[model samples]
Target: MSDDGDDPGRAGTGEPAPAEVGAKWARDRRNRVFLRRALAGVLVVAVVVVLGFSVRTSRLTDESGAFGPDLAPVMDRIAAENAEVEKNHPGAYVTVVAMFPMTGSLTDIGLNRESIRHGLEGIHLAQVWRNRQPSSPPYVRLLVGSDGPDDWEPTVEAIKARTADEHIVAVTGLGASTGTTRRTVESLSGSGYAMVSAVITSDELTGVRGLARVAALNSEQARAGVVHARKVNPGLKAVVIKDLNPADSYVKTLARFYTGSLADRERVMELSFDSSTRFSGTVLDVIAERVCNSGANTVLYAGRSEQLPALMQALSQRDRCVRPGMTVITGDDASEMNRKADLNMWGDTRIRLFYTALAHPAGLTLPGGEVLTAIRARFAGDDPDAFPRVFPHESLGDGMAIVHHDAMFVALETVKAFAREPDVPSPQDMANMLTSGTVAVEGASGPIRIVEGGARQTKEIPILQLNPDGTSAYSGRITMTDGGPGRS
Candidate 1:
């Protein structure tokens, strides 16, 4: 009777004794109290979570909704294509999870949602192409998994959970080159997944097991950028304006490599700023005063394009005592800047600005351009496969499509190269295949020559000049080999 843990049952047969009744009542009361506390705790947590993300989150839970409103059709197309590919190729198709920023501040910078749409569209085109290929067996099945750029740990776990059910062979299109991204790559790598990133450009990301990129590394871009900068600005006395955000791997490597690649006698005053500050407007103004006083003819801006306007504004309004027509060169983050920025609207004091392009449309001239042209034709419905059902041609201009296509192509090529018969290949098998030193992907950007070595896309890195007319002019092309920068 005193034992609350045991059953004091006999309710249907007869009335329980007073002690038994008291015991049952006490146990029931305790259970009710415990449940009530638990429910209250759960409610508290629910409110905290809602309040935490309410300001920042729009719809992170929706698979495609986070890409923005206009991209709903693109998401629908992906779903239809996903269904069609699995339907036609009725076998063990290998899955590749593309981890992109379905939600992030990428747009708060210079990037746009159309770029994300184009990337997914590119992946869809590749799926349709590969599934229909005569090569046969082991067609690709792409699963998108994004928990935003900053919070990828949860999605990594979710993807790991899906591996058995989804037959996931590899991961692709890893989002921005931040510390969070690096950790995700490392975690997925630890779990024996092959990760092919479309746009991860951190120099520090090299040599991580099962991690490869279809984009040029920051050092590669810097190496290529320096080759052009020296020729254009002869004296080349420069101020390196850099972002001090610890999480941003891209700008960190860009600043380091650009500084290292410069001539010993070429350095002037080096300036720094942390983009996280809301006070950038006033801060850049101070930096502008120092630049005017420093006698530097060029500004090697190692920051995202989000801060470009502030720098341009500050540079434009600076005292005319600074060397006129200063040249500003940056990394690949500037590739999409032209779409958001009105470069023509800036004052006359803002001179020439150059940035490295990861994969330019001009890459259509390369050997792989044959494949790119054929695939891109699908976007315009010029190809018989997509005729009268065109995806917008303008979406393909930003190179997201090309890089994302190349990322998927690299993953598929690894699968095809693995010598597997119509069965789900293990991620360890794909990881082994990638690191085996023979997986050369003929990327739409250019040939992705080295996956395991120091550089992934050791092909062409285009240097683009932001024009007064708000367009990018392909100023020059240089290649980055494991050996060094080479002629494209």
Candidate 2:
């Protein structure tokens, strides 16, 4: 009462009332509580998103069966037939095992599976031909196995085990990567097994007594690519970016051959990175800087298809650094880069990209066209719906499928030749028969000639150019001669 203003509702020295102070404290507490709940909610959402992404990636990389849903029944029938033949006449049936990559880069796994399916169809066609011969031919059965992505040991052991009990005359597939093929070859070297790869293109695999390939050697492909690049831009300065994967010996060999193919008039520079290396912003910046500083009009990339999206992104970011006439050249993996899902990433780049593939042009009147036609007819007659799944309607010109069909054709022919011999040949004898350069089978792609040193003599290579509209066009063709690559 002495005007001290010490009541509970008022401050003692001109401060706010007690009620106002309590209200402000309550509001601050409420705001802090709300903020904490909001933070918790955000953290939960972040975890969920991360987990969902991780699961999706895991599913994509998981190991899959050797055959797709549509083709598994076909394989089952072949297996049953093989069992019956073995029961009736031991060692009378020749078993060919196709080793494919069921898990790895998503694009590769899918392509490998598709190739295997079409290759099996080709074998079926060969079987029909053999049955119609004047004299009965030995039964040929195909079995599929997967080597996964990173390891080939399990698949190798399985092959060895099957060989011990069955008449597995030859081994094929494992062409998804050079490392897989090399490891399989090494495993079967002393084991006396014959291998004819559908797509393995490494020159290093040449001269392996028991191995043959349908696709051109990686070096050959590289030479073709370089020749085409030079033709497009005469006296073009090029910078080659090679992915160094010890497992994929093809990449290293490609880099070496490509750089060597450059003429003296053209300046050349080589750079290397590992397959596992991520193309981060910093890395792309460095690559762009290198290309601009070197004054290179051409950039050649020799690596996996999975890496192309990142490379395209990197290149797009450095559009300012890229010269007006810059072009990118790649190898057979170009189809992977042309996926529809990746259109947005590569469409805006506005850069000229050309890639070389082991393919024959569509609508070409070639000797092997008959075989392809026959195979298609057979597929239509057998299972039309399933045929579309294995041989996708759009994959009439898929180089991988074409090569696989050719490989199967060669393997079937080799087996047919051995079955006709007076005496049953040993596995080593069969291997010799394939690599001896004495057998030639005409296939859908071309003449399947296993020349000296177990190398396929590829006659033509298709070059595809990626347009700004996300469409690919057949730019031209290159022919590989005894000396080098020439325009077709």
Candidate 3:
């Protein structure tokens, strides 16, 4: 058992332990193969993990760059705007009932119907031009109601039915007396729609909670007129007038203020014209000559535009003119005033006249060229009867179109305001917004701002005078002293 080279336990074959050596060699080879395979597998797993992380990072970067800060604000604004549009502009059907005098000589009043429809169409065009923006509800449908020549009863019924249906959002026209327009307005006041009048100038209409006016009130515009008259005739002392009615509110107010403005030492007389007596050219001429010869060079002719041509003709027959130190008259509408002053324009004398025009900046162009051209296009096939040469159809059409342009612009801005607010809007909501808030918008009429009380904030009345060459230009704007028209 203990022999070193060949003990008893060793038999002495001398072949040596080949089997044990072979087994040890096999064990070492197996360990090395296992290590190589494990290293290769780990390398493959690491490569896969790095590639996955890189792909995720790249995707996140792409997403951030595509929808970055620039897009966020725009998206937010659009969503906000659309939310309001959905609330307000639900159906694209807006019913508008237009009431006007359609009988008598005023059958032509409905002739202005084409004008109103064209105005709405123009407004809708402007909106469409705003890059296809979402529009407020009610794609303006107009319904016209007329009574024979000046009867407004039919208009009242139409308005009642329209409002009762709760489909109409706005009403326009009713161009009769203020009383009839008032009835139509009162019927719809509680329905939460707006009432817009074209030429009704009575002051009482403005007090209604839901009505707005495109034409200036005769009572309100009268203020600047008197102030202007005084500016021209600083020493103007008296107004000789034939009062149609002594108790007429218009006559009373005008007389009271005009007399009060003169120097205390000056004497102002109010002459009453006989109601039964129709004034003839010879009579008016005699009166003017007598008045001019008697010391008072300044006279205020307070009458209708129809009477102006006759009055002026009588004065001309007597060699009198509306120049300073002669006679002066103020008129309401441009067409009528320009018509009566037709012959006066042929001469070289300076004539001072005043009328209210829709205020606009010099050189501001409307959507269409020359407002008259646009208005006429609407009547292309409808009414071929052209206006008389003396009517100044271009000027009248331009003026009225400019007014409509301004009103439409205000309405759009109001709609935009509703579109931006968080609350949803109905027609009622829009009317309420107009009552409670104000908006400043650049428009065809001019830079317009609607005040909280629904009155246009600007009092920039246009003042034009005829120069020696008979051309007219803006002299200056007489700022309104108070809210009301001046007394003269």
Candidate 4:
């Protein structure tokens, strides 16, 4: 047993005398393989754990319910009321779907959380307001939905699933002016559902049938900005700074509209940059140089609010233009910009930042604003039935609630108009009327009259003046078409 081998089994055999060395190497190789396997297993476990956690924490986009927990109770309350309507009068109530960005995109920069919340509140108030009316024939019920950032098919399908039972006549609170928004609108329109969007301002959303918008078209907004720029400066020579990102319809249409309108009646210069990447410094500096040397007193910025400060800084700290003061009017996206934190954009310059907003409470003082006068009263805690009862008063300033209320108001009114007809109106009937140039809705934003085929809309465009202290004041409102027609 103590011969010269590591083990007694191999000692007697003439097989190997270096059996101990071979055994040690064999053990070492086995240990190495075991260790590698163990490490690999641990790595796999770690990856699985991380993936599990990510999946658990990620937001579910296809909930087919309220996007936020705070919205659940309000929707539940509406649901209870809907049930009561069904019990009282089975076929009297029609469903209305409110689709806004409740889940997908949220950020801290511009009160996005508050925007969504208030928008929902506005929709709820519209439903309540319409039903509480004494002569209500076709009562309104609400179904709230939101789509994922990438896919909208599920949301559209969900809406379609409820069509038989819910009796959805029209959709309101349609979201922003992006491609997803267009697709959703198109899908719904093709389904014969009338749509009333709260805040879509793209010019390219034409040819879609039965789609109406409470917001002004990009062309109208451009005309407002240009007219204001002319009022600010009589000479009226202007430079346009725009985002060249092709994906965003808001900026593209804004840039196109601005340049087109400016070229028509005034002296115009154009400068642009692609904000899809991080070219804020280099490209903006060059744009600023041209602006400074152009002898133009006005800047029509057709870009998003996030990159506005960079452009402002670029325009600042440069050789002065011959013009005394600079009037800068941005697109509706500037409504989301932070005024206080972004006040440094002025930078000891004569730049006055003005933006065209879809809505403002101050516009209530304009012509035909008394319809929405209750918004002001209720925000002061006046009516328990109207807005600010569910939402905070501070949310009033952002105009999300106002616009949503207006949009829902448009859809509900359209449905009601058909409800009064001889035969019961289906969604197709509502769709026909929404673009028939016959329905005139007085929304909170102003008046919305969708022309034939729903190509355009006439509503008041609110111009908000950005103050030095990083707050905005309602300057004035521009009446599109003298309240003529068309919103899509």
Candidate topping lDDT? 1
How does each model score on lDDT? 0.68, 0.62, 0.43, 0.67
Q: Which lDDT value does model 2 have at 236?
A: 80
Ranking by lDDT, best first? 1, 4, 2, 3
Candidate 1: residue 269 lDDT (0-100): 66
Model 1: lowest-lDDT 10 consecutive positions: 1-10
lDDT (Cα, tens digit) per residue for candidate 4, span 215-274: 777777888888777777878888888887766788888888888776555756788888
Tens-place lDDT digits, model 1, residues 419-441:
32323468888887777677775
Model 3 lDDT per residue over 1-488, tens place: 00001112213766424233323433443454356557856765787788754211111111212223433332243234334433543333234444444344311231233333333333332332231322222223334445333455545545554452324555555453333345556666766666654445545455566565544544444555556666777765545444343322233343344454445544455544422245544455566566655565555554433344444444444443444435443423332333223345323243344444444322233343222333332223133222222122333232444455445545545544443232224556667766663555554444445556455554445555533232355544544424644322
The TM-score, computed over Cα atoms with residue i paired to residue i, of candidate 3 is 0.57
Relative to the unseen true structure, what is the C-alpha lDDT of residue 412 in candidate 2, on a scale of 0 to 100? 71
lDDT of 2 by residue, 175-288 (tens): 554665566687786777788877776677778878877787778888888888878888788888887766677677777777788776674677777765554335644776
Higher-TM-score candidate of 1 and 3 = 1
Cα error, candidate 3, residue 429 (Å): 4.4
Residue pairs in candidate 2 whose N, alpha carbon or C atoms collide under 3 angstroms? 201-218
Q: Local error of candidate 3 at 438, Å?
A: 3.1
lDDT of 4 at 219: 76
> Model 1: which residue pairs collide?
none
